[model samples]
Target: MKQLIIITFFLMSSVVLVAQPTFDLGIKAGINNSKVTFRASEYNSESIVKAHFGAFGRLGWGRIYVQPEAYFSSKGGEVFEEGTPSERAGRFDYNNIDIPVLLGVKVINGGMANVRVMAGPVFSVMTSNKIDGNDLLNKQYYEDNYFGYQYGIGVDVSNFFIDARMEHGGELYKHPTLDIDGKNQTFMITVGFKIL
Candidate 1:
């Protein structure tokens, strides 16, 4: 019995020592109900659905993990103004391209499931029509180089995951042309296979 106990302990320690660290690579995509909110009395909120696609990777130790991901995102919105500069009603459109680098951590060790939170910086470019030649729609787009912030939470159950994230972009100068930024938030539910 004494010899069996010693051998068992040695095997467990060897397993721990030999279990090399690991990482996962996969894909994520989902829907974003996006809108632009203006600070001016002449404008109202416009919502649009833009698609996103990207790859992700995770690297760390034990149940604690550090994940960094990057993806391409389309964003924009539309609204009808009650009054026109020269007429009765006016129409406006806006579009942008965004790239976000996110850092995340898992808060639960749910065997095959866990909850995660991620945050990072977003780079955005105004990619469409301009209002008053000023791109009032982009009034929020062009002001800063580091145009936005990224933060989100979701659950991962082995082969599936879901989360909602908020981002804030554009400079509220000259025009209150800031996007719901994060308010144009995303709710993503994805199915993936772990590839290392």
Candidate 2:
């Protein structure tokens, strides 16, 4: 019975040593170019650059992993009236808290570097908004909460990583009395360091 107990203990130890999963906790900051595209032909949209900062945690087994991130982001765009007497332009700015949960696969897993692809859904809650140059626009024209999706590729070398992603979403703003409907599209690039 003593020999059998020793054998079981060794087997369990070996299993534990062989099945180690990876975990990473990190902080990241990035820039994004965002645009709100309107469906009405009379309005033209242009992208605006903004900053985002956040923290992230990743857990993985083998080449498969899940990452969750929370970040503060400012997003919006500039709109121009195409056929107006003065060609009026308006700017829309929104501050938000964004949370994304992603599933990723490491396509190239090496000893020193790795490349991965990830896709996920994101939830955004608007904390505030600033509208300029348009008297008809207000907070009521924008959404307080919205859902979006993100897909991206990343490269990790040692403890540092970089990611490039594209985000798209449903309607972000709709005017109650006008034919104005807008959706958000953004491209983002970020760099991060792993703390764990």
Candidate 3:
């Protein structure tokens, strides 16, 4: 009976070791070009370049994985008058804390490199805002919290990884007395190194 128990224990340990899941945690920083679009056609919007820094973690079982990330992002856009090239209308600038939970799949799983695709929902909370050239627009016009979606592709080479993604945010601003509303669209690229 003692010999039988010892053999069973070794078998279980081997199974557990062979089926271990993969996990990695890392820090990342990236740049983004962001813009705000209005529902009204009379207002024209332009993109702005900004920076973001964050930490991310990934857990994987075979080719499927979940990644959760939190980052501080600076985003905004400038408004222009329709049909006017040089006339500056106004600008909206804000900082946000963004959190995204992504589901991803490895399309090409190689020994040293991999290609992946991912999509997920993101939640953002405004930390600060600045409205320029317009007295009618203030901090009150913007929502404190909002939701968005992100989709992207990524490549991993050894311990280094890179990702390119697009984000579309829900309604960010709505005027109290006017029919003006705005949302955010952004393109971002990031590079990171895995610590574990």
Candidate 4:
């Protein structure tokens, strides 16, 4: 009788483990509010709002998961100086491809709803950059690539998800002659649907 009970327990545990969900793939798109901040510049900056769209894949084991995403993003800002007739000092336009690999933990699991917190480093490859209607790519004013980080919270409901995140990028480019040092900062909101 004891042997039969032990056998039954093992069978049920194995079935439960096999039934757990482990992987998901999704597409996401959202709005991005971004800005470029100068470390030593005469002008103040303003936020540049744009849109970002991407696809992501997630792998999970128990309550922990790792997610990787690829996205096209637009980021830049406008500069303003004091005592200027025009409030606009100059405008920066940057387009890039970004990848973020995140590590996350599910903090709350409520059947149909789950709350998660995630953070990770990001790598951005620049596609183009312009300053005041001039091309900065050929001038070598900024680096072609940058390193950054993103952290935020997310909610998963049924097959849909919503996330809000903040990102800060490291120095993007360098202009020794012009004495320019700038970084990227952004706040983003995204919605996603699981397709696979």
Candidate 5:
């Protein structure tokens, strides 16, 4: 990933001979239907309020382009522990901040709209380690410090954009048979702006 970013930077410096780098800023918000699972573990699904509101920029030279974005996002995972009649089950919630950089290839373009495919790594940090009035359950999970990878496509029409992508922690946990291997898979949609 470092190599890819470096190469892209050099390419952008040279590509500006025709058209200089251009940028756009916007805000995005959406719902996250998340699941913490594995090939072995039990199913734990959570739907929390997930959204991103920040600034994004695009650098383009004719049809070939690259977009880099930095944003603050409230991301979390939830699981239902146990339940009974007239009693609600416990919940697991984690809130985080996500920073993503995307590299894209434009397949088609129009005067008022454009379509591109993107893939990149998201660097995330845990901002809140406690959830649902409990601090013990969320500690070890929050200690994980690593970059997750995401890939998706985008459709930009005038000032509106829609994105769909998948993300994973890429590691297994210590819970063994109940270990959560597939962690933090987020499906999101947010409205953005083209503040050129």
Candidate 6:
């Protein structure tokens, strides 16, 4: 029994020493096409194109993983209203800090490449907002923080990855008197390289 116990302990230690660690750090850059949707109005805004860049850290154990990222993103859209013999149009702009935490699983691990599916919640804080060339920060007309979610599929090849995702904002602005209830929706594609 004593000899068996010693052998078991030795085997466990050897397994621990030989196992590989499952952590990676990466950098990513992407483009986003974003729009604002109103709940009760037909005045839909046009989609705006923007760029996003960020760094992410991923931790994985076998086929399951979690990835958290911090990035800079640009958002907002143009609103146009048709009036009598005329048209009133303006644009809204915003710069934001976006953070997303995603849980994922590797569905196919093919030696040099892998396929993954992920979904998670995102939190964003507006750094600056402008409408029709007027700053919303000084005007105090809108909120600064927002919540959203994203789901996507990704392909990883060695140290590089590509991801395509759809994201939607939960609540934008709601004013019953003004009839302004809107949310944001975005489509994005990103490419990344693992650094660690």
Q: Pick the candidate with the highest lDDT.
A: 3
Q: Compared with the true structure, what per-residue lDDT tens digits does model 1 show for residues 131-190?
A: 442233434443333366778887888867776888776542233333333223333433
- Regions more than 4 Å wrong, model 5: 1-19, 38-40, 80-89, 133-140, 170-182
Name the top TM-score candidate: 3
**Per-residue lDDT of model 6, residues 1-196, tens digit only:** 9999999999987687558548999899999988777665545477889888989999987778899999998887766543412235566677778899999999997857999999999998888877773221122545678899999999999999999999898765555465666677889899999999
lDDT of 5 by residue, 1-196 (tens): 9999999999887877565654566666555555444344334445565566666777766666666666665555555433432123234555556777778876778857887788788777656654453321344544444577778777889888877777665441234344444456677665676766
In model 3, which range of ten residues has the least summed lDDT? 80-89
> How does model 3 score by TM-score?
0.87
Q: Model 6: runs farther than 4 Å from truth? A: 1-21, 82-87, 133-139
Predictions in order: lDDT: 0.59, 0.89, 0.90, 0.85, 0.61, 0.81
Tell me which of candidates 1 and 4 scores higher on lDDT.
4
Choose 5 or 6, whichever is better by lDDT. Answer: 6
Model 4 stretches astray by more than 4 angstroms? 1-21, 82-86, 133-139
Candidate 4, residue 179: the lDDT equals 56
Error of 5 at 196 (Å): 1.6
In candidate 1, how many Å is residue 179 off?
15
Go through the candidates in order and give the clash count of each.
Answer: 6, 0, 0, 2, 0, 0
User: How close is each model in CA RMSD to the real structure?
Assistant: 7.0, 4.9, 5.0, 4.4, 7.6, 4.9
Query: Model 3 residue 164 lDDT?
Result: 99
lDDT of 3 by residue, 52-158 (tens): 99899999877889999999999999887677664456778999999999999999999589999999999999999998875535668899999999999999999
In terms of lDDT, the poorest run of 10 residues in model 1 is 173-182
What residue pairs are clashing in model 2?
none
TM-score of each: 0.63, 0.86, 0.87, 0.83, 0.71, 0.81
Error of 5 at 187 (Å): 0.3
